[model samples]
Target chain A: MSQVLTIDGKDLAFDSGDTLFDVAQAQGIYIPHLCHHPDYPPQGNCKLCTVDVDGQSKCACTTQAETGMSVQTDSTTLTEYRRALTELLFSEGNHHCPGCERSGNCQLQATAYAQGMTYSSFKLLNPQRQIDASHPSVLLDRDRCILCGLCVRASAQEGKHIFTIAGRGSDSTLAVNSDSGLLADTNLSAEDRATQVCPVGALMVKQQGFRIPIGQRIYDQGTIDDLGNRRPQYHSPKSKTARIAGDSDD
Target chain B: MTESTTDSRSLTRVAIDPLTRVEGHGKVTLLLDENQVVQQARLHIVEFRGFERFIQGRPYWELPMVVQRLCGICPVSHHLAAGKAIDMLVGAEQLPPTAEKTRRLLHFAQVLQSHALHFFHLSSPDLLFGFSSKASERNIVGLLEKHPETALKGVKLRKFGQQLIETITGKRVHGSLVVPGGINKALKPAEINVYAKQMDEIIQWSTEALELAQGLYQADRKHADFGAIGSPTLSLCGNNGNFELYHGDLRVKDIDGTILLDHISNRDYLAHIEEEVKSWSYMKFPFLKRLGKDRGWYRVGPLARVLNCQQMDTPLAERARLELVNQCYPDQHQSVLLYHWARMIELLHCAESIQQVLKDSELTGGELVAPHGDRNPECYGIIEAPRGTLIHHYKVNDQDLVEEANLIVSTTSNNQAMNEAIRSVCRQYIDGHGVSEGLLNHIEVAVRAFDPCLSCATHALGKMPLSVEILSVAGHETQVLERTSQGEIQQRFYPC
Candidate 1:
């Protein structure tokens, strides 16, 4: 038997082995975060997940739950820090969310809203990205990439190395094997890139244009957020990662 | 103990994660002795494409569009294969007369592009340069740097094919217009003339390309030994017994050089052929297993086509093919190594096929798709896409909803044999003492010998990983979904 914990003076109950974030979720409370998909590997690198625990700011994903523990999800201090973190990530890459295709569905946009971020203080990194129209199935717009390395990881771990990161940290980007330096020359296949995985418009369907009517678009009937980022909530069954992860959930 | 000696249990297994520089991700493992004699070879065809069975509930017209998703590199193949099968299922004469001509043109266009891709992209590396180039320069770029004129010719030829595909199907890659029972559009005479011009240029260039291949063959003899799957190669060139690329009578030859099958109607394939399931791979091997042999590995596609046909239509390709056969000494090498040379020869033939089809009487002006009063309850289709022979069979019920489907793609035709070819290369080339990227790549590329649309052969990409929960279908009145990726379930409200 595990004792219940209180967060922000409210009683929250969870299983003994649940992570802090998992416990927070069971209470119907949320903490602003990105790079923390339940199905994907959690790195807690977003830094926006900082929460107040014993007067210390810590990531909720990696930290374990404790009995009689008191915590706050959105304190004044934590909110300010999270907003700052969002602003910096925005400035680090050329994530012009408004014009981006991934604008509505992107995690970066969702995190910014959650933290109540208004604007950025730092200038944009303004990295140049090549749009490959070679492979007929999908397109890869590099400028929108936040370097979350989700695609890189997906291609390597799940995709089993059909794609790879060719360079070093800041200098690195996902590169295909074709000499054309574009997807057209590489061996990138349709199944390699599913339509719904990308949060932003960075990866768009190339071959089938406007076949998905605006009324029936993925974002049309329900905002995944309003629906919840859980199965039948945040995840689309067509996503390769979501589908692969679905087995473990069962 | 048979030939090569030493530790028997320690077989060298090479895991080419995503096996690069080839179509689809799959791996090959080889068992051998210290003496280097090969034992068992297994090809793990990992991507599950179940295209054959997925179309049971879909519209007959959507089959071509859906089937096109099977291969990213050769969408036109499935589109044409499905179209041909649907046309036959409705009875060829029942189809709108113009539909047949348009389908043929589309088929030729696909052959042109696919054959060109094989020569330029898949097989050229081995022929244009040493098969193992450490320079890491492997692509059209590499081809251009070494031989600019040849690369340009290939680009032009392939582009011409794409133009024709786009013109007829309305899109370049995943074309959706080719309908069952008939086509969706017709090739205009003006468009036909342009295609003819492009075909003329392609014919000249591909002929020269074949000549260059002949010149290169004297220097490259090893390629002649690739994919020599036991005995006679399974082939589907043209039923006319000509080395044509469009319609064909399916044929299989035994190792004794006897024709086991001279004609195979699409409806009879199931009774004559059967697919064997293997736990080691996702690909199901189709064999004349009904013949009661040890599940004989049957092959169909380029190598099979070259072995099956004795004559080609294009004068230039016919001459080159004759020369290619004469040069092989014992003549059996025609199926073994000629797949590479045959692609170039087909490029020459496709160039001619494209030119002739464009001149057909119906393409100048005629109706495209035929009238569909209702869905046919059952139909079967078989046509030659660039990859090889393709088959689609469907069964529909009273309301015209689909009931059952079975597909046999060109890739399935070679599944078991591909495993055999990989082992042969492993024993001959790979060094277990160390990992040789070069040796590993050549063997992997050998699977490309069939140019399989791993996904296309499986079916298409519209597949969803749906998790169906069968909660005792509520009552005995619940309908049985005879076919579903989700297994069968009975109706009952038996709760936990």
Candidate 2:
């Protein structure tokens, strides 16, 4: 049934084509989601981009635009759901932001940082994901992938058709799918436009690596603040210990 | 790259590919006659993209990311401009004192790095190799052979600046760190002492560099005559008449040395400044409509900054300022070679200023941001780009995302002026019946003198080159236009 949703006391009408996340952003409410870039197709893989739709939960990225549907994108209840989701994503993935090349600009690191999720309370488990360092301009570390599907969509849709998903479900691994299993073996150039579109440090820019120092970036605090006090806010119940321990908190 | 000269000349019809003298991107052409006079000249800055236009619908918080893409070398310029613009958009200028100092120090670091790149990599070849040397080794490699110690100092100095940025931001290159409300990270005093020590060595290098740069013009006649005496152009910056780097009121002057707009808010930059697209290239020409076409040959950069400022601040710069003015015009030095010398003077000031700021105990973490909460007024941030005055203007909707964006980069301001510069250089060197590769290479290098990064200067994005042919009152002229590999073509034309 179609319904006008009142979220944080604002009237919002959900139509057939509206994503709850989209509606929330339009209403001046920010929802923290790393896997669901506004520009990329929603994976609902991280499940952090979840929102309450009508009386249930929905992954805002994959959820279809609907008509007259009431939606709640932010609240204490939803925040907890998001915290749990981001926490899991962090714990399941291997994210050593300080050591990662994409620490400052990595969406995963930024999300974890923004959500205050540092070290996982869950045992490291740190299952291994294959790391392919052969590609000159980009690398693939399966463990850090988050399986967000941003690289896949960007390469396939935005970049004419260089990348594809060969396997389905949990067996999924992003493959070059170009007759060869290697990235450097493909027709990709170092200046490949799609490769630069990655949200996390997963697809690292090869030539630009290790060029600048730690303290003097062009934008400073992960592109959110200069070198001063307006520090970025990261909160994740998963890494609650780190926040209190100065690793996650500003 | 070919240009045709005829009864009517258009700067758009010529192509000077692989512009020799600039830092990031270059190549321009001037169509002229047998009389050695230019009929038309097209400043074919073949790297252009619509970055401002691209960021139109992005969330305001995403501005730092978008604007930082302006220049790979000068990203700090864009970051600060965009951050200040957001400050205006959300009315959050009340950020605590710590935040302001953080930005100021970061900005200082960038200026240091950018100037080092310009002086050591872009222009040092000329300074070290004798401006008129016919040697093929006209680059950093050449400078290394002659002055290895100086070359090493240059690398370390630029590195120090980038190091400072990385330590605070977490990454050196593309950082999503700083924003409108406040700084995301703060510096520690203990670590800063390490930075200060390195800065001391850089200061020594800069002091020596100043002497070397001044000595070149004084002793070398061919270098002096070739580097000096160009048509003058004003570089506008903040500060009504005060000399400052990062922020202040703005003042515009003509190449003839007349002040136009003084103390104007960056919000009104476009209202006063008009950007014209030339058919020859992707780079746009920004002209003062009030001054009209040929007269709007205003430029921004070290030369322009020193000229526009009425008084000086800081002692080191003041002494160098006195020495630099002696090489000014009426002395007939059209070399445009003054960029290296001027940059060194600025570097001296930046280092000393860094010392002063480092001494501040208030630079520690606390009260950095004031939160985003307010109206959607058109916000504009106009600050001094290492190349010149840079402006970032944005109009946001109620949701605090960008409704529109317009950037007036330092390079854009000098587009018309650069066109003139190429024409003058071509007349001086390339206008004969035949042009050789080495000489032609030098002609392009002359344009490089300004370190013209059309990708940066144009407030645009990306580097794409397209060769086009245009037929007009003159004849068939080949021009290279700036286009993206994405198939986006940006062609512009300059008027006489």
Model 1 misplaced stretches (Cα beyond 4 Å):
A1-250, B1-12, B20-23, B34-37, B88-94, B237-239, B290-295, B327-336, B369-376, B431-434, B452-496
* Model 2 agreement with the true structure over B1-496: per-residue lDDT tens digits: 1233444443333454544222345565555444435566666666556777756644565577656766678888788888888777767866777878888888888888888877776566655665445334555666777789878888877888888777666657666446556776678778778777676677787788777667765666655544233443544454447677777766775544556667766666666677777676676777776776555546778877876777566687878886676556345334566766777788777887788788788788667566656755688887888888887888876534467877877877777656666566666665564333333445544555666453222212112333333334345433324444443554544442
Superposed model 2: Cα runs more than 4 Å off? A1-250, B1-14, B20-26, B32-39, B130-136, B223-240, B256-258, B329-335, B371-373, B452-496
Which 10-residue window in model 1 chain B sums to the lowest lDDT? Answer: B459-468
The CA lDDT at A154 in model 1 is: 57
Best by DockQ: 2
As a TM-score, model 2 comes out at 0.63
Question: Residue B71 CA error for candidate 2 (Å)?
Answer: 1.6
Choose the strongest candidate by lDDT.
Answer: 2
* Fnat per candidate: 0.00, 0.12
- What lDDT tens digits, residue by residue, belong to model 1 across residues A1-250? 7668778789877777777788877666666665465555666756666788878878887677898777888778887888788888787677754223343345667667666777887777877766454554556666665555555555555554545557786787756655667766755555552223445545554322222212233334444334333211123212211121221111
Q: Given candidate 2, what's the lDDT at residue B154?
A: 83
RMSD of candidate 1 to true structure, Å: 21.3
